[model samples]
Target chain A: MSHGVHDTAQARFAPGARVRVKPGRPERIAPMHLRTPHYVRGREGVVARALGRFPNPEDLAFGRPGEPRILYHVEFDQPPVWGEGEVGDTVLIEIFEHWLEEA
Target chain B: MAGTPLPESVELLDKLVAALKRRGVLVEEDIARCQTQAERAQPETGARMVARAWLDPEFRALMLRDGTAAAEAFGVAMAGAPPLGVLEDTDRLHHLVVCTLCSCYPRAVIGYPPHWYKSAAYRARAVREPRAVLAEFGTVLPAGVQVRVVDSTADYRWMVLPTRPAGTEGWSEEQLAAIVTRDCLVGVTLPVAENARIAA
Candidate 1:
């Protein structure tokens, strides 16, 4: 196991894995280290493109050069995301592959 | 701004400003300058690079790849600006920029970041809930395009090079730069009016 920055994070990779946020509660099993912005979280969108092999930010920020992980560009609907009657705009985030699963 | 910070040393600075204001040692205009309006003089080098890139695509790629290097390619010396990065907007991904901590902006390209860039509302909301933030800016993306909120922190500052709007193919570089407003380049708003200056 590469001692990268994301080493402390649990469940490095698995699609459609049941995941839940710790929600300031440390005891719960948090499947993915969530990087999805609070706005688009839970708002469903398809995976547009998977950008592979990028340094995990948890490591990159601290200068820990660990193994590269898969990154995905996740897209969400504008209306569904912002709610109805709002100007429609899709939201996309660059998330590590480990954070996602078969929804 | 990301370097080691000594405690809240800024409290001392603020107290000094308040004292000066009480004594009428400084005028409102002076305070404005020291507060915000007194940013580093706009780097002419960056302005010229923006104008040049409006005319050339090869230069555009270079700007995206090595931001500082590309600026110098057009004789724009990036002396005062902090290390800068260019984030390009594409058909699938739309970029919205913010500096959550302090205003770490790409002075080499679009000049000082707007006031909204540093507002607490913008900072707290941008990274937390991007969809709501973009709505505040009045930019509704197409049904399929995804909005990616890139935070410009102390170490890495970002500038959004908006996709060149259509209907300006035959326009000159000078004409194009006129449309590239500071807000547009920052990705807070879209470039409008083929040849008109972006409304401040």
Candidate 2:
């Protein structure tokens, strides 16, 4: 399925980078199945933070593969994104390392 | 006998919301909280963060690092009745939120979304091409700034707190909030002032 971010270079993820979940407390709940928003998956984003890991949402959402990966905060710019007429300069989103790659 | 035809969607949605509450997906207290905030809530944390970033390079970096935490530092509660997630607006990526299935939302933080937000036209078309969709809503953006679309599903909800508007060399938080219209918070419109279209 086409995920839909026009300028892939604007993302922070490396084309093929293996990142792990660095877990934490209530702040870092892991092994959870979650429906990672479509706009954020497989996009290149900088490793903004190493927020400790917990149950990943994918597992928690569907009740399968409960293994949690290190979560990283990723930020994206607006101009290159929506293709003209945006308010802010950048957008920030949280995602696991498994979702990143070199653009 | 009184004769009246109610908009089926409104009546149905109200009933569905009630049913969701009855089924424990949401509670009376949750509904009450959403109401109170919807009537009066504004994006204090987002505005303050943008303002501080405008003045401080470091805080902007922090905002980029952890939006929820950065918002919390400014005294905005990161957690809400329903979990809240931050969706930033970038140059290329525009953000719009919708819930076709239900009004799954981060009610505690940004407050209840407007009635139009959950509409089918918004939900379907927004995912197709958000910029065009926003334009239809009269939220014409400047030369730059891309639009990214966000879907509010049963599992997670989203909100877009537009960046601080221009003008007002120095405006108080309350004054700033005044200009931060409901449209701005939802990413449907931009908050403009000063040379930024003189919204006042």
Candidate 3:
């Protein structure tokens, strides 16, 4: 079994904890592959739940043994994500811990 | 015929394929076989899981607990696929799936995504304005019902366990499965029991 970071660390945020997606792209050695969507960048949301840790996809794309990152189901209200929408409607996204911070 | 070099992507693909074959790591037949398998596991494959979940309580619980095992119960192979997450739909909630960055779907459950799913327009508007997109698909949820747009990602895939339509009391699993269309599985539309009548 490929035991890695995902296996060792506890998730920083729990379900219902408010968090924010880190804004802007970080400089990196390898070309960035897809991870978080730009639409949700810098957006505020609550942790719907924590999911299993998997290899960081950004590193995986470059053929590296990417350390596992904690994945979370983050829920953003429609009003904040878009300029207009029903108040209660929300967009749920899967974000890794690295892309998130306590809001 | 050989006047111009092949398009860069095609040329690169040819070289890559040649190298893989030389290394005995891949073969042309494998690609064909994968395509065939993907085509076979279409919406119908998911319909079976949905219908069984609707008809059997224990099965529904099992499906919710472990989706991959649930697929295995139906003999659907899920090798090399991302974890399958089935979003449940109730009177108060509806789940819509999109890949804002790219088209990442539960191909094992729903087969290849439709052409429209990969369009840039869909990628942009789906998360921004899902209600309008749902309206375009002819599905209009009454006010107060929360619409949760599920953004499927590179490592995770999603599908909706659509709220089973009313007046389908005695329908067989096969008949129920028949109504679970691909669009409904995507949550763009709801399953319809067009022929079922509510018994008086």
Candidate 4:
């Protein structure tokens, strides 16, 4: 396992943490190669697992040495995302630490 | 008759491969070996692994603990492949896989991903409206069963070990393996005994 540029201690969130995706416009973040999806912005989910620290892909796309960021497997209730039509479903999205805030 | 022309993208890929070989970034023989390995590592390999896990408790534990190692033990070549994670589905919880960023899949184990798995609509709706997507795939779960959609967004590639369907008891490993389809491994559908009958 190749540890990227940072350590686990620098990680912002841990497993089981309740987090909300930070809402932002893609244009405001960068002009090209954004890793965080648009639909997930502003959605709330719990951290299912900590996927360890890795190079921030957003920076890596530009051939820069991306500073490592903690990634989490965030699980969201289906009803909240897609409404009552999907009451029994849950969706898990892998998100970086930068895009998350305490719920 | 003249052979059909290759797609522009494929032509470009061939050029890129030649360029890489010239630059010493890739070796032709190594690429050939990897291609052979990929061909051997088909969806049937994944199905076999699922069947073995269904039959042997120790293998199941090992599979859950370290998927890549378990795959290697079964002679599945995983060289230059992303790490594998096997999600076991129980009666209460189910699993689904998507690559929200791109079409990242466990190609080494399950071969090439289906076209739908690589579609933009799937990537968008799978997270936003998974139940609807699964419904379109003809996999309707009960109200009590919780669907867990896994995004293969990082270095880890995920596959589901769907719960063995009922009425498969006393069946041989090969018999059980017949029912485990690529969709079942991906969690889009469940393995039915009747499907096994048709396949057999």
Clashing pairs in 1: A4-A66, A15-A101, A15-A102, A16-A101, A16-A102, A89-B141, A90-B147, A91-B147, A92-B147
lDDT of each: 0.58, 0.54, 0.83, 0.82
Better of 1 and 2 by TM-score: 1
The C-alpha stretches of model 2 lying farther than 4 A from their native spots are A1-54, A58-67, A71-103, B1-61, B79-106, B150-166, B194-200
Return whichever of 3 and 4 wins on TM-score: 3
Q: What is the lDDT of candidate 2?
A: 0.54
Candidate 3, DockQ score (0 to 1)? 0.62
In candidate 3, which residue ranges exceed 4 Å CA deviation? A1-9, A27-30, B1-19, B195-200
Tell me how far candidate 1 lies from the true structure as C-alpha RMSD in angstroms.
9.5
Candidate 3, residue A11: the lDDT equals 84
| lDDT by residue for model 3 (A1-103), tens | 3532134357889888999899876545446786788878888999987777888888888898888788888999988776898888998888989999999
Which should have the higher DockQ, number 2 or number 4? 4
Residue B85's lDDT within candidate 3 is 79
DockQ of 1: 0.13
Candidate 4 local lDDT, B1-200, one digit each (tens): 12466799789999999999999998989989977866776788889999999999999998887788878987876666766778999989989899888998888679978888998898877777777888898999866888888877776788899999999999999998899999888888999899976876
lDDT over C-alpha atoms for residue A42 of model 3:
89
Clashing pairs in 3: none
DockQ of each: 0.13, 0.08, 0.62, 0.54
| Clash pairs detected, candidate 4 | none
lDDT string, candidate 3, B17-73, tens digits: 899999999899998898898778888888889999999999898887678778888
